[model samples]
Each structure stands twice: as C-alpha cells, then as structure tokens.
Target: MHIAEGFLPPAHAIAWGVASAPFVVHGVRSLTREVREHPESTLLLGASGAFTFVLSALKLPSVTGSCSHPTGTGLGAILFRPPIMAVLGTITLLFQALLLAHGGLTTLGANVFSMAIVGPWAGYGVYRLLRRWDVPLMVTVFFGAFVADLSTYCVTSVQLALAFPDPGSGFLGALGKFGSIFAVTQIPLAVSEGLLTVIVMRLLVQSSRGELTRLGVLLTKSATAAAKSGAVAR
Candidate 1:
C-alpha cells in the first residue's frame, strides 16, 4: 500500500531518509557500475523498470475496497541484480506518484525504503539461499515473496508508528494493529505473487533458455521446465 503524502510526519520522513541513505547509496553505486561496465545492463535495467510499472497496474482485489499488486521485484532480481532492482523499484514508485497518483511525493523516500530497497533485497537474498535447496522453485519464490511483502508492511508499520504516535498507542501496539492489517492482505497477495513469478520463470526457461542461462538461473530453469511440462501433461 502506498502511504499517502502528509500521512508521515516530517520528522519521521527525515529520520527514515537518513537511516535508509546508505542502502540507497550502495544500490545506486552498484547499479551504476554494472551499467557502465556491461553495455546490456542499462537496457535490461530499463526493461525491468517498464515491467515493474506494467505489473503494478495489474491489481488484484484483496479486500472489499482495497487491492494489492504484484511487486515484480522477485522476477527482476532473478533476472538481474538486486541493486538495480532497487533503483527500478524506486523509479517505478516515483512515476506512479507523479503520473498515476498512486503515492505522494513527500512520502516518496519512505515508500522507496520499504517497497523498493527492502523488498527486492530481501527476496533476492532468500532466493539465493534457497536456490540450492530441494524445495520447488515456486515454493522458494513464495517464501521469498512472503518475506518481502511482510517486510514492506513491517517498515510501513515503523514509519506509521513514528509519524503518528497516538498518545496512548505504544510502539508494540502500533505494530500489532497496523502490522496485522497488512498481514491479512499481504499473505494471500504474497502467495499470488509467488505463483505468478513461478509461472513467468517457467515460461522464460522454456521459450528463452539461453537468456535464463545468462541470468544464472539455469538450474532453476531445468527445474521449472520439467515442472511445467509435467503440469501441462497432467
């Protein structure tokens, strides 16, 4: 969920901005180096950005009046590097705020910290670790997405707690109430995202085997291909 502008107090925004600065810097530097050294990096990065925007537009209803959209970060990270995905996520969020009115400018940094920087890195980390395991790619993707989605909500909860410290609501209380709400919606949303990511991965492995190899998901490519082929025949 996009935190509206002015929803976060100025102090909270500034503080979180300060805290998240180093991670942002690291991501930018890492991406810049990749783009400069490898010519294809820039193009792939741009493509990921486009895909991120398109995926965000495809929303699934989570509750009566609200919806949750797939992040697309997991697929991006699987294809490219996590640092660039961070940049892509931030750029996507900015475009949504400016052109699509999905989020606000004042709260852009806060949203970036939570959804962009945190989600991609968290999911990518899990994927890297679990890629060696015996579990299915879909299952790994689901857990990676599950953690990423929940992490976004966790950071959002912290931001809200800091920005809107009700006279009676303590830190743990804020986490419980607000965090629980995101949990209810994001759990299913995460599962859906994982399933979509797995399907995409399977298709890519079958249609563009070389590309998946270049991206270093070759083992996963084989696994997903076999899994999909089996499912199709069944």
Candidate 2:
C-alpha cells in the first residue's frame, strides 16, 4: 500500500523513517550474507523483487489517501526469510516511487514498514507456524500469501488512523473506517494473490526444485522430489 507524499505529519514521517532504518540496515547485512553463501540464489532474489514490484505497482485508491494492492511478500519471505525480503522490498519500493511514481519518496519509510518488514514477518511467521502443524505445502503457501497481503493493509490502516484520527471517534474509529475501506478490495486481492503464489510455488517446485530445496523452500530434498514426482504423475 502506498501512502501519498506529504500525507503524514512531519513528526510521524520522520519517526517512521527512524524506526525503519535499523531494519533496512539489518536486512542489508542478512541479504549480503545469504548471497555470499548461496550465490545461485541471486537470480531467485531478483525474481522475487520483480514479482513484488509488478504486483505492488497495481495500486487502487482506498481511504485516507492510501491505496490497496498485493504486497507479494509471502513468496520471498517463505523462500528467502523476512530480513532478506525487507531489503529486497525496500529496493522495490524505491524503484516504484522513483521510476513509476506509484508511491512517493517522503513516505517510503512508512510504506517499507507496512509492505516490507511487517508483511514479510507476518507471512513468514504464519508459514512457519502452519508448517509446524504439518499442514499441506500448498495450504501453507496459500495462507502465507493471503495473510501477508491482508497484514500489509492492516498495518497501513493503522498508520493512516494514527496519522489522521477521526474527530469524534479518534484512532479506533478512524482505524475501523480505513480498515473497512481496504477490506472491501483487499480481501479478494489477498485471495487471488494467495492462489497465484501457490501456483508459482508449484511451478518452482516442478522446474526449479533444486533451487527451492537449496533455499529451504522445501524442507527436504525427498519432499521436493516427491512433489515433482506427483506433478509428473498428474
């Protein structure tokens, strides 16, 4: 979700920037180490960033001068981890703001927190939790994408509510209003993105099982092979 420029108060904007700085720094270090250890993943990283860029760029207007779109953080977070997703996501946001003008530079920090840091962490957490529960791989992937997309909008609603509270209802009321607006569009988009992510994950498992395995996208080589074998059978 893109928060338009000059929408946030100076204090709020600067505060978000300050809060997001450490995450970006940490993400850079984490991504650097991951690349060093697995040079082959560089292409995968680029692909993930591209996916994010394309999906997030399709913004639809929503309440409080914000917009709704798929965060597309789930696949990357599931494959590369949240820290690396944060770095990649920031880069995607930067390009979208600068080149596409879909988002703005002044509000980059707020956008990063919602779309990059929080969304990835939420999706990755849900994925890991569901996997621990022994859920099916496709189900896990679907929920990861769905939850991540919704979580990004949820965080964006909060940011808007905090920035522009309702006169009579205050932050809670404003949050509910903004959230309802986003939910109307974001829910279907989240579901669509979840399905798309499952398809992409299956394709990766089929054509690039080795890469998914190396990234630990599939927990075991045997599982990856089994998935491929099943696809072949189908």
Candidate 3:
C-alpha cells in the first residue's frame, strides 16, 4: 500500500521519516558490504530490486489515498536477508514515486518503513521459524511471502489510523476501519503473491540452483534429507 502525497499530517510524516532513517542507513551499509564481498550476487540483487519495482507498481485502488499491491519483498528477504531487501525496497519505492507516481516523496519513509523494514523482517522471521521447524521449503516460502505482503498493508493501516484517528471513537476505532478496508482486497492479494513467489522460487531452484543454495534457500541434499526425516518424525 502506498499513501498518497501529502495525505499524512506534517507532524506524522516527519515522525515517520525520523523513525525510518536509521534502518535505511543501515540497509545501505549492508547492501554495500554484500556487493563488495560477493560480486557474483550483484545480478541477483538487481533482479530482486526489479521484481519489487514491477510488482509494487501494479497498484490497485483500495482505501482512499492508498492502494493495494504485492510487496515483492519476501523473495529478496529470503534470498538476500532483510537488510539487503531494505536497500532494494527503498530503491524500488523511490523509483515508483518518481516515475509512476504510485507513492509520494513525502510518504517515502513511511512506505519504506512498512514495506521495506517491517515486511521483510516479519516475512523472514516466519521463513526462518518455519524452516527450523522442518516445514516444506515451498510451504515456508509461501507463508513468508504471504506474511510480508499482508503485513505491509497492516502497517499502512496503523499509520493511517494514527495520523487520522476517528474524532468520536479514537485511534482503535480508526484502526479497525482502515484495517477492514484494506483487508477487503489485501487478503486475496497476499495469497496470490505467496503463490507467485513460490512459482518464482521454483524457477530459481531449477535455473539458479547454485545461487539459491549459496543463499541458503535450497538446502544441501543431506540437509534436505535430514529435514524431511525430522518432519516425518514429528
């Protein structure tokens, strides 16, 4: 979800910008280190950024002053980790704001905070947790992408609610209203994104197995066997 230009109060906008600055700075450092250490990953990194840009640019009209779309952050988070995804996500958002007018400059921090910082971290958390539990790789991937997509909208709703709380019912009521409006389209969109992520992962597994394995996405044969056994035992 992208909040329209100037939709948020100046105070809230500045506050969100202040809140999001550190993560973006850290992300830049992380990305630089990644590219320096593993020059081979540069191509994949660009692909990840492109994926986020293309998917997020397909904005669907949803709540007023905002729209719903696939975040396309989870795949990068899974492959490159959340820190790297943060950099890619920020770049994607910046380009979209400038070129497509999907999001606004004023709201960039808020959007990056929700989609780049929180979404990737949240999705990667789920992915790691599920992997540790010996869940099927594709299944874990699907849920990870699903969470990442949905969480962005959830955070957007929270931001909106905080900025424009209902006069009579207050922050919680406003949160409920915004959350409900977003859910009307976001839920199914999340599921679709999850499935699409799985398909892309499948392709990567076939064509770029080495890279996927290097990224720790595709387990070694021994590890896969062990994980399968662990799942069976459970």
**Among these predicted structures, which one has the highest TM-score?**
3
For lDDT, candidate 1 versus 2, the one ahead is 2
Candidate 1 wrong stretches, greater than 4 Å: 41-43, 63-65, 219-234
Candidate 2 residue-wise lDDT, 82-200, digit = tens:
99899988998898888877667888999999989999999999999998676999999999999989998898899999999999999999999988877556887888789989988
Each candidate: RMSD = 6.2, 5.4, 3.0
How does residue 199 of candidate 2 score in lDDT? Answer: 88
For 1-234, candidate 1 gives per-residue lDDT tens digits of 678877777877677667666766877897888778776656656766776776667787775346777677777766776776777788888888899878788788898888887877788888777875556666776667666666776777777766666567677777676776665667667777777777766776677676656667675657678867877798
lDDT of 3 by residue, 122-230 (tens): 9999999999987899999999999999999899999999999999999999999988877556887788789989998888888899889888898889988987888
Residue-level error in angstroms, candidate 3, position 231: 12
**Stretches > 4 Å off in candidate 2:** 59-67, 221-234
lDDT of each: 0.73, 0.86, 0.88
